[model samples]
Target: MTGPDRTPPPGDPARDGDAGAAGRFADFGPPRRVDGGLKARSTRGAIGVSWWSRRFLEVLESFALGTRLTRGRSYARKGQVLRLDVTPGRVEATVQGSRAEPYRVGIELPVFPAALWERVERDLAAQAFFSARLLAGDLPAELEEVFADAGAPLFPSGVAELTQRCSCPDFAVPCKHLAATFYLLAEAFDADPFQLLHWRGRGRAELLDRLRALRAGATDPAGATDPAGTPEPSGPDTGAPDAAFAGPTPDVEPVPAAGAARVLAGLPAIPLDEAVDRFWLPPVPLPDRPPTLATGPELLLRQLGAPAPAIGGPGLLERLRRAYRSFGRS
Candidate 1:
């Protein structure tokens, strides 16, 4: 929704350039407009587009490079303004320019197939704004015919004659105003690719719905003729019968009433040696050894490899005292 092609002829006055009249594009009903058009949110579109896109804004500022924007020129830096209008088969984007000629450009958008939307999002606009994404990159591969139909190159150079000209006298270089408008448009795309889509008059939700319709139509080719034909699929019979009336079966057999069960006490006992050998044994205490500072409290202090006082438990301090006491005595 940026502007017309470089060689864009003046649009037909009899028509509103395919997007309809100015009033149609500016229709801001309840819940859609906010702060008087500073912000307009579509009720259906998730517009999940990150509330902010750094790269999109960067591209916008990219257009601002070498312009008065770098020098802080106020009027020259004013950005582009955009809006959208949607219909079943068409989307309209109103692209305003800071420079002359067609002060505004109206772009008509046809129902884009689902297959191309992602490519449009990723490689084109980086998915910043749906409408902006539509116009961001060179025309998508799927729509090569459209560009050819319009007699425009897929990629218009910054200085390409195919690029639409401005009424403003500023020549070769896009007038500062045009740059500002483009810069702002890029920012709008950065903010939300939906904006571009919106300008094109096609929001994310609408695009998805159209795609879904197309999918349904494709899947129901036979039904397409009937339109309302509800074809009952001749699939394998997978339906189950009502479960409440299933047949009953014979009961399980019961064991004899007086059957005996073995008791633990009645079992044969093991011999003492066998029992003793098989029983779990506590870990055996190691032979006592003299205390070594390395082992700390775990060290077994002794006269010479004897168990330390109760394994350094009760009277632990007394045991240490005695160890030192023997040092001087003998």
Candidate 2:
């Protein structure tokens, strides 16, 4: 029975329904503008640096709500987002819109339970590549595959896995503010991918310590304890000498008191600056012979175990000793 131009008259029930629809449309009006907000470092091009970060964005874009991200992108580029705080399984943020006060936003993901994380830590410890890189504080690019193999996907698999909300009037689930926060998050992952792991209910230090413990236990299956329950020595023990064996013993030289007393008295007196420069600066070619204890700083330290007030502060004397320690090692 309905046809074009057969519209409900004003003040009618049907007319009221049309007014409600118009009011809902008005809610999507121009988003509030933000000035001096936190701008995305990337003014143009993609927001993420690594493949994982880019993939994160691609996943967001794939959602039915993906097209809404365009407005989010604009907000992000313009730096409309005010503050973003990320924690394990949760993110809280604020985005400045066309209003005097900023809109609050939140995003949540499920934290992997302790049991699942234990399995992940054990399996990751077993992979030499994963362990080596992780110990070095670098997350492997292929780490996602490891999570998949362990039956837990690190990134959100779909919109169902993520819960997003905004205080803005926009009925769109994410609204543009959520999008801006997401773009900023991708940049965060680029800087430190370990954040992704941290978000999954484990922190960098905790995970590293656990991996170290697992490795140590695997290497020492006996539990490394003595009958008394005290920890046994970690280093290898050199068994007692063979009673029947004969080996050449190193010759030991006896110290001559008078000679040692005369050693420091022998060197010619030189200006303090000249002596210090000679000690610090290396020669074009290193000398063929090493400086003996009697001729170098060792003699000074031995004579003055408690250094003079002038040279003692800030461990200046200790540093001099360290300088000589490097000689043999180098």
Candidate 3:
């Protein structure tokens, strides 16, 4: 069983105690390293590469863990962490410390309830851009805002939101060993941002499936809901025939059925040989000029935003705009 929350308040020197002192001392010495350890890819400077991972590390730093975090960073660099596993609501790891036996470490964050996730998934599915980016394995920076708007912050906002534990004899909430694990966790998140979602109680497959279902439902409301409970619409064939013609068409005149049939029967039947020369040509004369545009040619380019860097840089849009203007003038 886990012990009571002995985590001292932020900036409390008592929290560090003897463990804090040892952490500082360990900066000068090295802990027992492990073979085939999961070392951080970033050897120098910052640990996390992606923005999401950096945001996690930033949250950890804000906890005021002081020298212990520094020692953990050192431990991470030395590859002292033996193994790490991230699951829904928890991160478990084994770290090689000064002792012969490895220290067990765990960090827990509250998982969003199913109802909250439903809301989050709905919001995400509502936007095609967000769904497309996620499917392409790219986590947009704006996703954090999405979660925040849903009342479920994607990253832990404060230290209190995290429950940290280490089997090491450190009274400090996160001994150097735990700190090292945290750093590595950030790196892991950098590699696959879906790991962060997994830690928050939603696996990538499950989330993606739900997103797809929600999007499908949005497009077809008559379909049945998926297992995830997203509403899906039935086929268009189920709708009434009149529903297809529900919209108004003020300019169109409805042809009488008898008149239409007579018109079709009255058409002249020409021999294939006689019509061969004009088979591909229009029966009527073409317009004297092309149709005029209601908007400028550059309007499309403006709506599409900027082209990719490989296609054109910042000035490309301006040059294209000028070229489009010349087309109209000519």
Model number with the top TM-score: 3
- Judged by whole-model lDDT over C-alpha atoms, candidate 2 comes out at 0.66
Give the lDDT of residue 300 in candidate 2: 38
Query: What TM-score fits each model?
Result: 0.30, 0.59, 0.61
The CA lDDT of each predicted structure is 0.34, 0.66, 0.73
Clash tally for model 2: 2
Better of 1 and 2 by lDDT: 2
TM-score of 1: 0.30
Q: Write the per-residue lDDT of candidate 3 for residues 141-237, one digit (tens) a residue.
A: 7677667766788888776788888876666767788889999999888889999999999999999999998776554434356899986544555
Q: Rank the candidates by TM-score, best first.
A: 3, 2, 1
- Pick out the ten consecutive residues of candidate 3 with the lowest summed lDDT: 254-263
Top lDDT model: 3
